[model samples]
Target: MSGLRQEIGQKAQAEGFSTPRFARLAHDLEQQARLRAFIAEGRHGDMAWMAETEERRGSPLSLWPEAKSAIVLAHSYGQEFDPLERLQDKQSGVIASYALNRDYHLLVKGKLKRLGQWLSHRAKTKVKVFLDTAPVMEKPLAQKAGLGWQGKHTNLVSRELGSWFFIGTIFTTAEIEPDAPEQDHCGSCRACLDICPTAAFPAPYQLDARRCISYLTIEHEGHIAPEFRVAMGNRIYGCDDCLAVCPWNKFAAAASDARLLARDALTSPPLSQLLELDDAAFRALFTASPVKRSGRNRFLRNVLIAAGNSGDTALVPKVTALLSDPSPLVRAMAVWALSRLTAKPEFAALRNDLMNSEADMDVRREWETA
Candidate 1:
């Protein structure tokens, strides 16, 4: 059985997972307190689920007493193509590297399930797999399992793989030996903190999700705050400035998974085409991809912000067409984009429409300076 555990690790390596480790299911009160403090401070933003299962997230044993061991896995998804290169084009929206290909949750979960099934067949014990879907604190579990240490950015960073890997876990009744916990290697490195465009990191090892571009553009819905929009640059979907600026990523490998590799359309998408995506078109464009979860209305809302920041008059017509969108959110952003594109004359021209328009107060505010 022990030899089989080693075989599993070898198999994981063969499958392109950078590192794999086993961790005993146990409580970590100190880590739990940190999570509580983060939630107490309202750092989670609209992600209510993070606070819902406090107990389960605090301890792996509490979630499943029968699970004696956790198999932690890390897969590198970074591409050889520099993610930061997209930022060079002021007119193109920068989608995060993780979302450039297929949804990672599905891809990693499928891999975990395959591994778990193999372990169950060999050990004749119950095995349950997770890929960032459960109440389990995956990063902490991975850290405790000796996969890597959580860096200043609060992401697990390994010496070899850097922080460009996705984590997966498998809980099993089999009593596999545990690995020693990894220690932090970030010695006086504030590169990640200094690189944030929105200052999302309030302190080292802590993230205020509300200010995070990834959170705002993807998880967040409705109107975006006035302050962060311009700073958002052309990152319409998710921001990678923090991830791209990390010095450790030089060691990160290009994705071995074909599904995780960057697709042609998303590699460096034109901002104009993104702004023109209607509901059906958006759905079809990102059908199986992670981007579809944001929906067309919110996505177009982001595009409007990007268009506004673009300072390119070429996107004016695309922004103008969305003013009459059924979704008030989209309409409001359209007004904001048009305002950013044109000056007082454009505002005066659209003054009567702005006055009579049923736009939100926030959107109307953009017109005040138009």
Candidate 2:
């Protein structure tokens, strides 16, 4: 039993994953109850999938009945540079550090799948692997496996890896020893809470996804509400403010995985350049990246808000061009951006010129408000 755990850890580390930890399958519902409360309070916002898969997320066995043990691994995506530093360049759109290069889903999950295959063949037992794509409540399972503790921001924080690692798991019928769960280390630190541009945290450990810029920019499909636009600043993809400020990050090393390093273009993409990304260009820019999954219209909608916050009058013409964008999500945000970057009279003139011709009620509302 102990040999199997050692073997899996060695194999996972060889595959660019952290040394694996083990946890036994159980009928635990502690995390599930918290999930229920989060959904009941509508803290998940438009992430309806969390509610849709509520029962299935109860435990690993919910997804696989035959499982008796679990193997957990962490893959670090820590950056060499401070991601917050990029936020200072207001003229450029800041993408979350995680999405600055290759998508983790493909890289992390692919490595885990190979590890699972090896374990199944060696032990002659069935195995199933999972990452963020599954409803397995990975953070809780990771904590149970002694991988890390869920910190004040509701993200798992490892003493060795800080807050910059992705969790992966393999569930198998073979019984293995479960490691002692990691204990909470967050004391009086309020850096992650106070640094939020939109005040996403309602209480110490409670997050309101509605106010989260990451949710607003990535998951929320509709037009960004006016209040969060300015706070969003130049973040066009996702916000890393809370994650970057964690003091635990001092222990995190720069990612050794060459595949996960930040791409030159995505590090601090200029708002002017990003705004010019039409559908085809957008696809080309983010073909293998996670940003593509959010789709062009939604990404542009965020960029326009960043443009609004930029105060870079140089972007005014580019922002004006998006007024005629086919997507109302883009056009509405364009109206909002123009109001900020251009003079009031110029914005009023553009509205007077474009309002009557605008058909979408949402775009018309933007014009009426501008």
Candidate 3:
């Protein structure tokens, strides 16, 4: 069993995974309690899916009763440049490092499936694979597999790879020797917690997703509260302030996978050009990228918020053009952007003119409050 595990690890590394480890399928009592607490507090925001599948997500055994061992895999997608520095360019959007390239779900899952087939053939046993889309609690499973310990920011931080890797899992009926779990190494360090723009971390290991900029920009559905808008700055898709500040990144290496490398166009996309995207243009621009999942309206809504926080008068006309946008969500955010960019008197005049004609109640409310 130990020799087989060694062979699997070598194969996984060659397939582009950082390292792979085996973990016995057992109920993680501590993680289950933490997840229950998180759900009870409504910390997941609009992500009701977490509550819907809590039981299955709580343990690998519940997900697949036949599974006896989990092969946890990690793939490093470490940033080549400082993700935080892009925030200084207010005219451009600061997309998260992970989403700056092809969607990792597609990339990682392909590799995992191929590896699963090889493992099943070798052991003559059944196997199943999963990426982030699955209900599995991958972070906890990764910790149990000795991939890394969960950092103070509540993200997996590796001594070798920092917090800049994607995790995938393979569940199988074959028994394998489990690796020793990693222990917490974060000592007297609060860089990740202190640097959060929205203070999403309520405690050392607890996160309030409601106030998280990444949640607000990506998973969130409607109008972002006024308080978080300014703090959001130019991040249109996701925020990386907390992750980039982790000191352990000094030992990290740049992503070697060509498919995971950051695309130049998405690195620092111009807010002005993004504002002009209609549905067709938006779909074409983000095809195969995770940003497309947000849909045209929701993505544009984020762009409008970034434009509002930009304080650039040049974006006023671009924002004003969306006042009559087909989607109420886009129109509402456009109203907020216009109010921020235009002088009070000019904004009032424009609002008065547009208010009577606006049919969407939410969009009208934005103008009324402006």
Error (Å) of candidate 2 at residue 145 is 0.8
Q: How accurate locally, in lDDT, is each candidate?
A: 0.85, 0.89, 0.91
RMSD of 2: 0.9
lDDT, ranked from best to worst: 3, 2, 1
Best by lDDT: 3
Off by over 4 Å in 3: none
Q: Could you estimate the TM-score for every candidate?
A: 0.96, 0.98, 0.98
Residue 150, model 1, lDDT: 87
Q: Tens-digit lDDT track for model 3 on 200-227?
A: 9999999999999899989999888888
Tell me the spans in candidate 2 whose CA falls farther than 4 Å from its real position: none
Steric clash pairs (candidate 1):
none
Q: For candidate 2, report its TM-score.
A: 0.98
Cα displacement (Å) at residue 190, model 1:
0.4
Name the lDDT of candidate 2.
0.89
